[model samples]
Target chain A: MPNSTDTPSNDTPSNDTGSFNPTARSRVKRLHERGKYDEASVFAILDAAFIAHIGYVIDGQPFVTPTAYWRQGQTLYWHGSAASRMLRFQEAGVPACVTVTHLDGLVMARSGFHHSINYRSVMAFGMAKLVADPQEEAAQLDLFVDRLYPGRRATLRPNEPQELKGTTVIAMEIEEASAKTRSGHPKDDEADYALDCWAGVIPIHQVVGRPIADPLLKAGVAFPKGLAGYRDGARFDELLTTNMV
Target chain B: MPNSTDTPSNDTPSNDTGSFNPTARSRVKRLHERGKYDEASVFAILDAAFIAHIGYVIDGQPFVTPTAYWRQGQTLYWHGSAASRMLRFQEAGVPACVTVTHLDGLVMARSGFHHSINYRSVMAFGMAKLVADPQEEAAQLDLFVDRLYPGRRATLRPNEPQELKGTTVIAMEIEEASAKTRSGHPKDDEADYALDCWAGVIPIHQVVGRPIADPLLKAGVAFPKGLAGYRDGARFDELLTTNMV
Candidate 1:
């Protein structure tokens, strides 16, 4: 029997309702077995990552920009300075592909050909539209804060009017998406199994270290409840999923 | 005086001669102060990361695929199955951009507008060419393994002829490249400093955990010396730089 912890929660029906129909553009070509199209798998990978690399084209030239991102349902949002070329181009409803990846481990095998890395990645394709309504933009900004650290919006200073004016938020209603994941131990050649090489996995983890307070922090201010649990050595995935409240 | 460890070794002249002249296509449009054009910065960012998001266009639609990559001087290399769409299009000498990013920390601020992530990223643009020479391709494959684990290629079973034939290696002689880096605490509005919110940085680190040996490993085998320092709690950046023998 497989361990429950080893099985990802992508099969829970509550979060697995809609399936993203992969188009020829969004399909995983190389490894068909690792492809996943379910909403649950896509959402889980998106929610787990705060940064995404967005790819777009301009006059036959392709550019990939790394930026902060947040997801709400099937819609994804990212913001930057109002003058950002990436945001401006994306706001015009251009073809875009946003990808998020998490590195899990290094799979060491007895043979060089079989070495691989365990990772989970999602590629979402959509046309991004500018969020024009001021109220909607403000609400999305709040949600961004809440997504990073839940309840953080209520404690922090609100965005000033000028701040909102200088920022551009673009939303992409995902039209097609797919996720590819690789996990577990290496599969070496049958004959190489008896070789004296050490074969195994070295798990990789993204962890949070001790928080450094700002030099100008108010003397009596205490660490907020939203950040208290984010202690040194805490796992990033655990902090992201468990602190959603 | 600043601590020596805090300064990245980007000023070493032996590796920092040429500057990548920015083409109209590769210029950083916003926040020009963070842009770097020198080879040292670009190579440092590329060497620190094993994975890269490669962007290319097929039929006017852009796609970003994440894959493992290694850098040799000004040339970048990534491999996949012979049938991979990304490698196929890239090998046709189309415009391609390979980007590598390292997320350093989360900047928490008194105002939502100032929240940002400290990161280092490099974007390299070029035309990718297929490595058709079997001997050159095989040598590059060995270099890839040695890049990850120093002296690791000699200890493993060599790549079989069939294995070499099944894989496709793509190389991009970087035409233009630039790096962007942001570090330190958040800079909030002047008046917001008096607010009671906790404002600071929570450093993020990618670390290696305990190694899990293969279930079918021979009983008397010992951990390789190259992997001994990669025990639990080892910092990934330090390991990457220090292990490059």
Candidate 2:
């Protein structure tokens, strides 16, 4: 999601448009047209969701940990206890592959070979950076609150250091990445289209139900105005994307 | 998601129950209570979702690929072009981590430290196995079509050899795995409950909209009975879970 951080992968070959250079490891090999290397496109896909599956290695075994993540400037961050194996291993600046995906539709093609999916996904490669500086950690902790509830940070009680004492946050600079997306109806073979089988797109959407207030909430407290956008039926990605804009 | 693949990790201590014995790498380290090693629990979580992020390594660089996947017996399968880098690299039985997650709610807390998420996630680890035999590949290919569309496989045209000529299917026996879940309302600090800040949960749901038929569908075509289970407003997980049941 590096809009201005478009300093292409070191000395790799980048075209004039400021897109990421397709290195041997980062290029999309299949269905090449669906691959996107531009920062704006990558960032939009990244911002649409706060959840990601982080791929990292411990020994030779690869582990994909699904966690809530946030992006600030060119860096990406996720949190866990200081005791977490992932956080502990990442402190030494291990390579990390952070991937976020939004599956949008069920594509039912006339033939099994043509069936596909519609999704928006961003796969980023980078070295994990542990926020060891106390000041940087404190600042980032505050930014995490604003990720979803933008201006509400000013109104909420501050986190007690002890409350989050053992937690650690890890960051990555999105060194090299690609965004891949597919949408719309399925593409069937020309001959198969004439078959009577039903073939179409069943669009999938993640929507929010009405917010349930805490039972012990104060008498005069109303739903935070900063979070009014999270109404019933509000689309999750739309809320995050709107906040990005 | 294995119900009968009950053999625990070799030489690892396990209680009387048939759940997978947690080894050094497979155990959930943080919130101990949320980790479920029993087969039924793990399979339910895995069956509820059809998409997974696979973590695999090429060189020392890890890559996370989000793909559509299906489960049968104790094995998990996902497909791609035979020439795809991820598939080609995984053909040699690489150590892979497949993770599936359902993010259910956003927990808004009175204090930043108490904020959390309600989610159901499954992580499976095993060596990748390429389905190389032609007959085995053909059978698995047929199973893939039925994963989402159930009995509609009987109504569709068979895939031409050339249609899927270069595609490959990869399988991994889910040797060791764990399911993690969290639900219910926000757990805020006792003193923070008296604060005026809003604290609650915005429940998330993935639902289907009305299915759109292909524009070129024949005039006499009707929605297939096998797919009638998929209707407007059906929950994506519910659809899959029901089929699994």
Candidate 3:
């Protein structure tokens, strides 16, 4: 008999309901078996990543802009100077492709050529729209701050009217999405078992180090207690996502 | 007295002389200050990375393609199956931008808002063209093998006619390029010092583990020396480009 833990869930909600919506998987990858097209899985990957590469067309030329982003439900938001050229995409209703990838570790296979990365990534396709509602935009803006540092939204002065005018919030409702990931150790051939080669994950990690104080900070400002003792290591995204929000 | 090492060369070569051609500082990273653009410095960052996000267009919609790539001189190469949709971009003479970034470490600053990555990235913008010459195509194909594994070009069988026909090789000249880098510890403000926050860099690294043997390999085929003891850490592109052909 197989191990009890190895069985697949028979009654889990299909891709349409619950947290299992895998919408777009075919165009992005050849081996669909390894791709996870579910909405929850896709959102987890996107939220875990701190940076995104947003691609858009400007006057018939293509440009890829790398910036920071945050997600709320099915909507993704990115902020920048209102005068920024990227904001123009939102004004025109142009289709934009936003992508996020987290490189967890490098995978070394028995075959030198099969080396890969242990990563989680999401490619979201959608048409971007400018967030114009004052209350909704303010909530999204606070979410961006909360995403960067948890529980500190009330510590600072609220956004003034001019500050809001100088900032643009562009959002996209994820229409098509796909995620591909590779994890685990090397998959070697049977005959090469006896070969004297070190084979195991070297273990890549992104740890949080001690924080550096800013040069211009006022002398009496104390460090936030929440940021103390942060170490660089892998944490499951589920727990991380909850804590971050 | 100022250090002698900081001075510029007194002599400038004539335009016709080979010496007059200033060393190409990895054309992709021209945005950085000269001191930060050395070949070893730039290559070190490139080798420790994999999977560049490529941006291009189809119709008026922008598309970002994540693909595996290798660099040679001032040119970068990527290929896919002939039938792949990505191949059509090269055939159509459209411009594309490719970016490769190595996330070396995480920046933890006194203020959570200023946190960032210590990264080395190269962005190349140019038109991509497909390789058509049969002999040149064959040479470039061999270059790919030699690139993936240092000593395998002579050992592996040449690409059969069918394989050649099924693959498409596209090369980009890396026209407008820039490499931006942020390294070292966090840059925090002075007032945050007394806050007793620990500020530093969590150095992230990619290391290769032991290789797995292929399951279908013949019982007696020994692992080649070139394939053994390969340390594929975070600096993947740097390793592949510098030592390989």
Q: Say which candidate scores most in lDDT.
A: 1
Report clash pairs, candidate 2: none
Q: What is the per-residue lDDT of model 2 for residues B1-245, given as tens digits with 9 covering 90 to 100?
A: 01111212212223544576678888987776677787777777888898999999888889999988988878899888887889998898999999999888888878777777888899999998789887788788888888788886778787678656677899999899988877766766567778888877789989888889878877888877767767877788889878532
Least accurate stretch of 10 residues (summed lDDT) in model 2 chain A?
A: A1-10
Give the DockQ-based CAPRI class for model 2: medium
How do these models rank on TM-score, best leading? 1, 2, 3
Please, what is the TM-score per model? Answer: 0.94, 0.91, 0.72
* Candidate 1: CAPRI quality band: medium
Give the per-residue lDDT of model 2 (tens digit) for A1-245.
00111112111223444566778878886776677888777777888898999999888889999988999867899887888889999988999999999888888878887777778889999999799887788788888888888887788776667646677989999888898877777777678878888887889989888999877777888987767788888889999878532
Q: Considering chain A alone, report the TM-score of candidate 2 relative to the true chain A.
A: 0.90
The sequence of per-residue lDDT tens digits that candidate 1 reaches over residues A102-197 is: 998998889888888888899999998899999999999999988888888999877779889989999999999999887888877678889999
When summed lDDT is taken over every stretch of 10 residues in candidate 3 chain A, the lowest stretch is A1-10
For A1-245, candidate 3 gives per-residue lDDT tens digits of 01011112122224663333444323553444446667766776787676688888776666676767888888788877676667855755778889887665544344333334466667888888899887887788778766755665565545557657767789988877777665655555444345444343444444443344445444656656664433333332332465533
lDDT rank order: 1, 2, 3
* Winner by lDDT between candidate 3 and candidate 1: 1
